[model samples]
Every structure is written in structure tokens, then in C-alpha cells.
Target: MGTNQVEMCPVARLIFVVYLLVTTCSASPPNFVLLFADDLGFGDLGCYGHPTSITPNLDRLAADGLRFTDFYCTSPVCSPSRASLLTGRYQTRSGVYPGVFYPGSRGGLPLNETTIAEVLKPLGYATAAMGKWHLGLGQNGMYLPTRQGFDHFLGVPYSHDMGPCQNLTCFPPDIKCFGHCDQDVVTIPLMYDDIIKQQPVDFLDLERAYSDFATDFITMSAKKKQPFFLYYPSHHTHYPQFAGPGAAGWSRRGPFGDSLLEFDSTVGNLLSTLENTGVLNNTLILFTADNGPELMRMSRGGNAGLLKCGKGTTYEGGMREPAIAYWPGIITPGVTHELASTLDILPTFAKLAGAKLPMVQLDGVDMTDILVNQGPSKREAMMFYPTDPSVRYGMFALRLGKYKAHFYTRGAGHSETTPDHDCHIISILTPHDPPLLFDLESDPSENYPLSLQGRPDLQALLQKIQAVREKFEATMEFGESQIDKGIDPNLEPCCTPQCTPKPSCCQCD
Candidate 1:
């Protein structure tokens, strides 16, 4: 038979070639699991250099793959940031820009906007979103995860803290106050698909449940030989930082650290599940945060490392996040300071899965070359937006190469040491009649501002900003992000066939 193999002739060789092609074409696509955390800072994990939080699994994952020192979220807040992350479009362009869409708000990410799930669905990936769904809960049934292309959904409709116990009047709430935590005070509905699984799930029970859901989903997909995409927007390291039972005070960092520990454990468990299922090698896992730390809570809030300020600001500490990508043998293990953002997740995944890209303008680019080949990313410059998109007072930064220009600065999103705000932001504008510039490479802190009087670099930066601004305004007609208007709160859709129950707490976090 061995001798006959060579003697079989040209037709046999052609048949073998065709067999190889068919086998390769029908091979399973890489399974994707996006572990996105809420309010996690730039220096919150052991892999990212936090002294107190020991995240061994994440650290090992980083060691086994790639870690990014300068990844960013599109918005400083949750809803808009999540929208940008899912669509790969700037939050402003997504029209979800006025701010987060509240529970009663009729606004949602327009169905026209393509999410990573929608892109992968046509390619046969079984997609599920297992945690926070802050984009929209429109009554028109237009904005829920079920409508957004996710095959399965579990977790809250929005932030765990948007409960009835909201600290609306007393933000940076008092320790004694239950604010967004006490189930009696406020309860974010924990849903399984569109039906309410639990109207008021104990906040402490979330991380463990999400991990269980994710692990089971992975196992089921593996058994079926189907590719899976798990978009888990974790509810840890966020406000009312409640650790699950037996997890409190597990770390020296206090309750926040305890919460982080729980999240870390889940990561370890998920990886083990992947390995046990024999899919670890072919899976593409990404870990990142929605935005930076919430600095109002002091020690309870996360540390943003050397980056200044924290959440709700356009500053580095607010938008810049710690990012890691892992695949057993595919991605080269290393670290890079390349500028990347959550906006790139959609495009990069689509590129890897052989899925079709949305026809709209996308702010994110494929970083597959950077992830696997250790090659430079095509991302050249990144545009930073104001903390409040409603008022364009110019508190923004535009990065070109190694230089960044500050078009505006204010006292609102100041350093951690800054006091609790009282409904008014004290403007501390950095001179921008002709914006201030900073060489982020030399001065990562933005301590010294460069004069833009007659420098070529300044002219180049301004020209770049102008070009970006033009494009930003091109789609400014505001498509479906009318989150504040047309809110009937009556048309909400669900999975229980014609379900139309209005969501309870759609308020902002």
C-alpha cells in the first residue's frame, strides 16, 4: 500500500490535496471569551503591578501570552464605553453619547450598529453575554442583549449599583449608607434571558454565578463542537464592592481587594475549564476593563498606578486600562506599550473568526498582526473625548505618535486627592486658545505643558485633531442614541415570547 501511494498517479495527488483543503476549511474557529471587568483600574491586577491584589491566574495568562500597557476605553463612563466596545465605534459616533442610557430611557444602541456578536453569528459562533448589559433596555424591545445578537444572557440589565438605594443626592456616599448595595434599598434585576430570574439577587452572588454560566457555556460549546464567544462584563471591582461569602477580607486591600480576589478565582476556574475541555489551545481569551478606577471611594476604589486621576475623566487613569490577550500557542508571550483600545476588539475578533465587518465607519482596527506576530499595530493616533459629551467645553486630548495635546482641562475630573464634587465643575483649563501639548513619552504625567507658539509639532498635532474632528462630525446627525427621548418604557422586549415588562432601575450609575 505504501508503494502504491506513490504509483497511484496525478489523480490521487489531486484527491489528497482536495481532502486537505476541505478539512482545513471546515475546522472550528477559535473560541473567544472576553472577560471585561467594571471600574477596574490601570494598576489593579498582579499582572499589572498592584502590590496588594495577587492575581496569579491572570499573571500566568499574561506570562503565557501578551499584555498591553496602554489600552483604552472609548468613554470614561459605563454605558457609553460598553457601547463603543461592542460596536468598535467612538461613543460619540455610536450616538449613545449624551451619556449612559438609563432604565426608563427610550434610547438604545440603534439596531443598525453592528456588535461583535452580530458579526460572529453568521459565521456559526454561539455567542453569549453573561454580565452587565448597560447599553439599553428600551421598552420598544429594541435594546436588550437578546436583540443585540447574544444567544444567551444572564446578569443584571445595568450596573448593580443603580438600585433604589441610589446615592443620587449624596455621591461619594457615606460608608454607613447602603448606596447601590442594600438589596432592600435597590435591586438590579438579575435576568436569565428576558425573564427576571431573580428580581433582587444578592450583589455578593454575581461573580461566582457569572463564572459558572461562562464555564458551562464553554463546556456545552466544546461538546457540540461549536465555536463560542462569551462576552462577560464582570460586576466586580465596582461600587458597593461586595465580595461573595467566604471571600470578604481575603486580601489586605480591604473589600475591594476581596472582590478582586473573587474575580481572579473565577478566571482561574474558567481557564481550568478550558483546559479540561481540551479547547485551551484553540481559544482566544481577552481580559480588560470598561474604564479606570472609581476614585471617589478612596481605599475602596481601585488604584490607577502612576496614571493620574481615575474614572469619569478623559485623563489617562480614567480611559487607559490594563489589557491582556492569551491563546496557548498562537500569541507570542510578551508585553508592549503600543496604544490600543476596546474599540479594536470587534474588528480584531472579526478578522480572526473570518466574520464579515460592519459597513459603517469603525474607530477600531484589527490588532491580529500585533497579537500573533508581535508586529506593530496599524493604530497611529488615538482621540480622547470630554468627560461629559453634552457640553463640549474642550476637555479632551488627542494623541499623535508620542505627543498628546490637551485641548481642555477642568477641576471636575481632577486627581484622587480632589474633594467630592457638588454639582458644579471648577474649570482649571490648560491654555488652549492654541491647545497645550505634552510629550507622553518623556512626561507621562502631563506635569509640564509645551508651548504651541511656533512649533512644527504643534502645527502637525492641530492638523491631525482637525482631521479627526471633521470625521467625528460627519456622522453627528445622531442616529439611534436618542437615549433620553421617546422613552415609553412600555415596549421593552424579552425572551419569554412577547414579554413586555418595564425594567425597574434604568438610572445611571
Candidate 2:
């Protein structure tokens, strides 16, 4: 027999066994833990090169995983970005084309859509949401975390600052006083299911509150043999920075730095918990922020450098975020200059868990390979829309490769009736307009833009961005007629008679 034929003997069985081992090694399911920081900037983390900032835990986490340098949030603000994340679709598709929603806001993830929890739940994964829930709080028996997909929900229904507040203090009036403001500031305790547990005596240092809840969720899930998903969206370093007692000493950088220190400690605590639980090796931890920092706090906040514009505007700072993916055994550590987005999380997690998605349109792409293999991002284009005219100040932007095009109009009232006025004057909005193209390979800060006057490559990039903008607009279901009628009245206010707060919209006892 030839040598090739001779391999069919018992010795060949040894080779087959080795092949099986290798294949099995490649097919393991990973536990996913997403740590979403609220309104943290691109330069907030130490790994991102923030000077004098203390984010050791995050820095170490970045070292352990692949840090994505060009990651973008689907939207610049919290509610819209989160809506995109949970649905893996643009928030506009779900009617969240606006600001953060409240119990009475007529907006939320549509019932037809499937959340990561809903997708993974059927596949034997224990899913839980442990922090902020900015999606609508359905008008009575219609919308709630448990109804959405999460088996457990513990934390604020919206932004931590959303609850009844006086002078920006998050304290809700005391229930004992029948909603009277007798006591100083009534500490708004966190809500678990329907009960208010410990009142957060002072948000000036509420970082520990978020961390403690996340730790509890981790420990609880670790005890179960099944894979688990923890969506820990922290209320930290957003605004009105509350520096915890442990970080009170760092008040020199103002409340902002104090909040930063507290955030670092919280991340460190979670990592330590994973280590102690012995599941650190198998868990996939994702760290990112909702959007850029509040620009008004620049003196108190970090910088985004030449990327242009800050929060409340459709600039890089408003949309770009610091992202790190750490799964010790699965992902190799390095800097990935890929263009990724927050919307990819839902589908990515679903693919990892072998979960089936309900038939529906999704905007996020499955980037599991990019996460595992590493290198240049597979995504070629990214688009953003400030649906809410108020928050974004009437702007829309799209980025294709290196070229970014944005249109800005003055808010509310202005007419082209006068010679100096034009009906929605469409000038190149940004200082770096006329579609300035940056060779990101050479310019990381985006300070220098190569002249596009003679550059066909840049022109093509601009055209590509325009195409993306068109596609985005075509996909959007705008106008009052497209609104869902079944959504709770509180979520979608109605002028029809006999409309009271819907049952599902009210907090349950």
C-alpha cells in the first residue's frame, strides 16, 4: 500500500483524536458580561491615554483584551444608543429617535423585537439587567424589564437623575410624608422589582451602589451551571458627579475626577469578584460608554482632542466611544482599529449563544470574527442621526472610511424670507467641512486633514458617506402616522378622551 493508504491503520485513529480535540477547543461557548458606563468619554480610561486619571482596573482590562480604537456608539446619547444596543437595530426603527424616555414617554423597544436576554434565554442562558433601563416604562402592564426579557431587573428605570428631583438632587420626596418635601433630600433608594431597598442617601457617591448590585448579580449567576449574561449599565461619571467616600480625596479634579475614581474602583471590584468565582477565564467582559462626556464639563472633564465637537452635537466626541473586549481565553489582546458600534452587541451575543433571532430588520452586523480574529475592522461605514431636534440641535452626520459629512441647522425658528437667510441653508457645517479626509493611519487625533481638492479617493469616500445617509433615511419610519398604537398611553401620549396613566406605566407594588 502507498504511504497515504497506510495512514488508514490504527495510527490514523490517533490523528483523528487530535483533530477532535482541536475542533472542540474552537467550539466552546463563552459567558458574556457587558459593562456599559454612562456618558464616559473616549479619553477617560487610562489605556486610552488619559493623564492624571485613575482607571487602573479598566486599564488592566484593556490590556487583557482587544481595545477597539475606532468604536462608535450608534447614537450620541444614552436612551437612543441603549435602544440600538438591546435591539441590534437603529433606535429610529423602534421609535426611540429622541431623548431619554420616561414612564410617560411614548417610546420603547417594540414588542416584535427580541432583546439579547430574550434571544439567549431560550438557549439556556440566564440573563439579567442590573442597572439603568432608559427604554420606556410602559403605560400600565405594557412595558417593564421582566416583560421585555430580563429575568431579573434591579436599578433605575431611567437615568439615575430622572427620578423626582429638587435642584438636581436625585432624592424623591419621602413616601412617609405622602410625597411631601419635609425631610432634607429623601435618598432615592434603588428599586428591585417593585420595592425600594436602601435609599441612596447621597448621589454625591453612588458609584458603590451600582458596583454592589453588579457584584451580586455576578456571584448569583456564577452559582448556576448555565451560561449567563449580565447587562451592567452603570450610572457613573455622567453628570452631577457623585464622588464616593473612598474617592473623596480626589476632589481636586472636581466632582468629575472623584466620579472617575469611583468608577475605576467599581470596575476593579467586579474583576476581583470574577477572579474569586473562578469563572474569570471563561467570561467575556465588554467595557464601553454610552457616549462622549458632557462638553460643558470640559474643564471638569477629559478631552476628545481633534475628533471635533462634543456631546449634544453630531461630532466624533458625541458618537465615538472607548471600547474594550476582554475574554481571557478566546480574544487576543491588542489594539483593533476596526469601526465597530454598540448596536452589534445584541446580534453578536446571540450568535455566540446559538440563539435564534425572530424575523425582523436589524442594523448591527455580527462582528464575532472581528472580536476573535482581531485586526482591521470589517465595518466600512457608520451613520448617525440626532432624531430629537432639541438634543442634537437639528443635525445629522455620516462617516464613511475617513470622510465625514454633517449638516447642521439652527433650532426651531428661522426663515429664509430675508436675503441673508436661506431656507435651511446647507453650508459645510463643521470647521473641517467640505468633507475633510484624514488618514487615520497617520493621524490618530484627526488634527491634520489631507487636502481633498485634487484627491479623488477622498471624493469617493464622501460619496460613500452620502450613500449611507440615504440608506439610513430610507430605513427610518418617520412621521406621526408610523407610531405604534398598542404601546402604553404613558409611552405614547394620546389626546383621546378618558386617558389616564396606563396600568403598565405605573410602578408595581
TM-score of 2: 0.77
Task: List per-prediction Cα lDDT, in the order shown.
Answer: 0.73, 0.62
Against the true structure, what is every candidate's RMSD? 8.3, 9.2
Candidate 2, residues 60-96, lDDT tens digits: the string is 9888777877788877678778877888877766766
Q: What lDDT tens digits, residue by residue, belong to model 1 across residues 269-304?
A: 899999999999878899999887888677777877
Off by over 4 Å in 1: 1-24, 165-186, 390-395, 413-424, 428-431, 453-477, 486-509
Give lDDT: candidate 1, residue 277.
Answer: 96
TM values, all candidates: 0.85, 0.77
**Residue pairs with backbone overlap in model 1:** 102-506, 103-506, 107-483, 139-491, 139-492, 140-491, 141-493, 164-186
